[model samples]
Target chain A: MALTLMKGSEAIAEAAIRAGCRYFFGYPITPQTEIPEYMSERMPEIGGCFLQAESEVGAINMVYGAAGTGERVLTSSSSPGVSLKQEGISYIAGAKLPCVIMNVMRGGPGLGSIQAGQADYFQATKGGGHGDYHLVVFAPASVQEAIDIMSVAFDTADKYQCPVMIVADGMICQMMEPVELPEMKEYKVDLEKKPWAANGHGFSKKSGRSIINSMYINTEDLTVHNQNLQAIYREIEANEVRFEAYNMENAEIIVTAFGTVARIAKSAIDDLKEEGINVGLFRPITLWPFPYKELHDAAVAPGVKAVLDVELNAGQMLEDVKLAVNGDTKVDLLSRLGSQMPTPEEIKEKLLSMREVL
Target chain B: MKEVIVLIGNYGSGKTELALNFAFRAARQGKKVELLDLDMVNTYFRLTDRANLVKSHEIRLVSPNFVHSSVETLSLPAEVASAFALDWDTVIFDVGGDPAGATALGRYKEDFDALPEGSLTVLNVVNTRRPMAGTPAKLVRLMRDMGRPSRQAVSGFINNTNLARLARPEDLRYGYEVIREASIASGVPVLYTTGRPDLLETFLSEGHDPAFIGEPMAIETFMHRDWETFTKEGL
Candidate 1:
């Protein structure tokens, strides 16, 4: 075990590798490119599989192939590249395949820029791929959190038979921060326990018949399958919502954001507090199944006049805040689009503007 | 005024194919079009390859040749800017897949300030199977991710129908309407439709900003028709 400085994206890759991820497939795209590049060099050294796929499409499908065999699998790409892999991601979700997907977000609509951004919030949390499915979406704002979440993501995926995404932005991917590596536990997955995997079913009668994650049988059966998925999602929502709250006591404004935007929000909140402005922060650690109840309570607190939603993209997460607050509190948006990130000073100015309205 | 077209879209939505087609059409129209390969993501097919096709029509092909084809950063060479200062009829920047590539545009954004405001069109390809393909809310978010409020930036999107092969006109029409409505809602504009080559006549005749080509039409047609259907319905 060793403590070292690592970029958020690199930490996730290294952590997953140490956690017994034997296969890695990805197409290089910005923000998240270092993960695959790192794995490309590191995986071979550890006697693992590292493939630079023909395209993002090919990379996710390759992940499906590996995951179907009950292997530890991972893929990383940026927003545009992740968009290309949606079909495969949806298929993986439908199949209940356990794998890791990392999206280092950048600004967009089309060809936006390579700078750090949190614009992919909705896409990552609301099932970016498709179908009535959910992924364990972990938003890691710091490099250490990024590494910690990788193990959590893999475990969550395995526990629930689902895919997981370590959703970070370009800042987390590119910035270097100190990390204390946890004691590495080398793992050898017992595919024998996963009878549903594509591994040959002839090993033991107790292993049962192999299974696939498709819902293509009869319409009613498909409906039943969908209902089952809904139930699973409900279970996840009930049990897995997570977040971090800082200095809410007697606070006037609760600034909400996730990923890199959250870190900026934190800095803004701190700076405002120093200036005698009571601004608090509620940062969601798990984006999907958003920490709505915490946000609701935060909004309803006395003297909490307004909530400012900050993001790299304009007003995408603001809608969710609206839904969460249900009009009990006013929601204001201070946002930047494409590759531009709102600095702490900018966010502080926004909070100051909320003074009159709140 | 220099018209700058920034080709953009989800992969498999045919942004590249449309860029190629636009290059051909713009060059054919006797406009001094410079095809700039700004796509740093996908390594394979790039606008750089069609330099001859554009050169034949006197369309200047401008791109920095990297030692490695796989490198994804598109740095606007100084020469390209020098040419831009000189009166090029149009400049097409085949920007990479998403905002990451768009960030690269920040370096050359000053160059764009020199062009007429409305002439800079950011082409959004509507592909259904891709993320945010069928949802307007998601599309709006995608726009936000690209940068907000698109008013000063993205003027319009090009609805390129799955690389333009096996694409029904209905898909093209749907993509047009959805993106058009999105643009209107966001105060941007839907410039034109990118679909099958045959449909090019329809758009050309209709004067829909000149038809743009879509994807790997032959292979993606049958399998990725969901994109076509989504684009059609969205429009």
Candidate 2:
């Protein structure tokens, strides 16, 4: 495929389409509105369905209904909007329906600034909704990574019958870049393949009347269901911990970050390398699986001094870094909350200051 | 003599960035510049979002009234309607996206029509990387179609093809070729081959400087991926 210049949202929408997404239900939100806008333009041409839900709550439930049909369904929104969808997301997770959610995060405790943010790390990774469940969250740093991860995200959601969240910051959506869009998947939306689908009760005679609900009336049965969900999460954690270790060869410190911050820090790490500070970066690709072992190994390598967790939020991912480092090394945080972002020079300064402390 | 230039282009074609640069450059030259952001359709990453950046310079940004309100309602203010009657040396309308967005310009038809012939120029910004407007034919089609709803004939073309931070000197030459072909096809002059200062310097250093309309305007990118690099003050 030839590279074409496209905005991040458009690229991701196109990626979902190529990945066999035939239904896109979303609401208009800052940063991520273009995702639904693009889908609205393309979905009809490809015989797909694009519906702009009245609200994020309505959108996620629509995704829930669509996913239950065993079709690749996508719903995207920003911070506040994603928060609105949490209940539906929890319900979808509980029901074990496969679907993909893309959150182009913005700063917030409420309706925060329309700027890029990674504050949703905890909400996405630790399960924002009330349930003993974990969402497989992929945090991509660049527009290309975000686009590339969409197809895999849908597949991963389908494979585990779980909801996978592609949580990129607003920059990844607002930025323009040349992307090689994926080839369209040769996928037939076969309800028979999904024997468990409530697609008109498997589109024919079905298994036990095909009821899709999270309500397990019996307490013991619910316990077994919760256990099964936990087992799936464990399986995910074991097989799907994805992260990148940059310049860790004889690194005195690890500037661990995720998503857009990781990219900015990578530039800072390169600059720091030229300035004689043996610093590196540990960027987690999967926020939920957390890359604990790999991160711990990188942090505990010989001559490694300390670890610095940086983020767009006020150190939400810092907790995860602490858990990963697990006292194997000293851990600190450098962050700017809300809509503010630290430049690469600022990141370099923070790393240099950390070096001085070590 | 006050000059009013409206910029029209496809989505993601660097119209707002060019408008900001043109406004700032003219203001820096001591011109009383008034910028009318006719792009309410795009709520974020538009001129209204960069109110602080515009304030940092000499330019007066005529933002919509409801831009900063609790309601994200998009409505035209008196200032937008009275943009032409105002006393400003240079007025740049960062018009909305494509032909669809050009309808915003249609509302100011009388204001644009009353302007002296020599004082008005609607320049179509063509980013060749966007395949929808990549070729000479497509560029011409955009020039003709975008002019209809905009109520102004596109007098020129601004070749803004770029990979942003990844842009190089050759990319300029590539865009120049496509845009130059479109310019020839439509008899629309190539006003400026705009690029970031760094990329322009690289192009000059490589000794590929060619004769076109003046020196290519070196734009200060106000949005897109490197937004953090420029929006620090705005935030």
Candidate 3:
């Protein structure tokens, strides 16, 4: 496919459509509003449903209802909106339903600024809602990666029968970059084929009724369900941990970042390389099943001095990096709080300053 | 030769993309280019987002002070006033999308009026796919709406009909016919039509008029959402 420039949020919506996601429910939010806007225009033409719900809470519940029918469903929102959908997301996860949710994060603790920030790292990776559930989180650095990740997000969701979250920042949601879109997949919505789907199959001798509910009244049943959820999370952590290491071998300082911040860190690494400073970059593609083993291996590699966690928020992902390094090396943070972004030069200067400690 | 070009269009008419491409094209042709990003409406996908890229191509970019800044204010920077006084071979104003967006251009009405009579050209960009300019009458109405507020006459129209990477020769033809009708109704000439470089040959082979086509300018869709592609691999 030829490369065409696209905004990250719009591309993700188009990719979901190509992946045969026929049901979309979302509300308007800055930075990520284009996703719903694009879906509203394209969904009806493709024989799919696009609905602008009254609120993020309503939108996520709609997704929950749609995914219960075994249909590929998608919902997108920004940080505050994502918070509103937490109850629905937790319910969807508890029901063991498959759906794709996108959180194009903005600066937030409350109703924060409408700019890029990685403060949601802990919220996304460490269950946002009250539960022992873990969502498979994918963080894309570029528009192309956003497309590719979204193309498979539905499949990943269906394979595990769990909700998958594509965690991106406002920068990725707003920036335009060249991307090659994926081919449209053939999707058929046949309720009869999915026996587990709650598509009005009445309780009879031949057909068994399927119930979709998150309320496990029995304590023992809920405990076992929690155990099963943990097993799934363990499997995801074991098999689906993805990360990209750039110039990690023979590195003095290893910088860790994810999503758009990782791309900026890569640029900083390149500039430092030109100046004869050996700085490597470790980008976690899957935020929730984070590349812990890989990051630890890289941090413990010979001649590795310190690991810097560059982020748009003040030290949210630094804890994860420190956990991965496990005292083998000092894991510090260089961040811009409240939606501010660190430029390549600023990151390079921080990396240079860490040389004395190394 | 036109020294000043002002682009006005409905929302999603590809006006900003066209303005950016035109600035780079003029610079590549050895003309000193100055691009004024007069888009104060939409925060994202503005010319200021590509300021460094435009600067790299030697095109001077004049944008609001808060562009790409954390301030998020809509106040225009003082540099925009100096843009009119600066001497450059080509000065392009990338007006914001929609009639309301064109109101920002009113601040520089006197500077634009003081230019040589034929040197300043206001081009209304049209795409048939956009709701505001889907028909000839709607296109004309959009032109008048934008022209009145900006205090600039719409001298010509640029047919930028496209569906991102899915643009077919037939799509361009459909857009051209709509633009043709719009031109006759509004009495404004069709300056040129833009499309992918690869599709231009197909447009000509399909018997599109060379007169209305003008020189085949290779216009790329730089402002697109992420899942939109230009390749025919799947189709």
Best by lDDT: 2
Summarize candidate 3's per-residue lDDT along A203-269 as a digit string, tens digits.
4522556888888899999998888888988888888888899998689989999987888788778
**Candidate 3 deviant stretches above 4 angstroms:** A189-194, A201-207, B1-6, B10-14, B17-41, B45-95, B98-122, B126-156, B159-189, B193-208, B215-235
Candidate 3 residue-wise lDDT at A141: 89
Candidate 3 chain A weakest ten by summed lDDT: A199-208
User: Candidate 3 residues B167-221, lDDT tens each?
Assistant: 6676578788998888888788888788887776677678776656655677865
Candidate 2 C-alpha lDDT tens digits along A1-358: 5667888888889889999999999999887888987888788878999999999999999999989888899999998999999999999999999999999998887988777888888899888999898899999888788888999898899889999999987778877777778888855656655667876644454556667899999999999999999999999999888898899998999999998888878878888789887888999999998899898899899999999898898889898889888898999888888767778888888878878878
Model 2 error, position A322 (Å):
1.9
Q: State how far residue A253 of model 1 sits from its true place (Å).
A: 0.9
What order do you get sorting by lDDT, best first? Answer: 2, 3, 1
Give fnat, all candidates: 0.00, 0.39, 0.14
* Error at A123, model 1, angstroms: 1.8
Tell me the tens digit of each residue's lDDT in model 1 across B108-180.
Answer: 7666777765777777766543323545555666667665322226656666543233345555555555665
Tell me the TM-score of candidate 1's A chain: 0.95
Better of 2 and 3 by DockQ: 2
The candidate that achieves the highest DockQ relative to the unseen native structure = 2
- The whole-model lDDT of each prediction reads 0.71, 0.83, 0.82
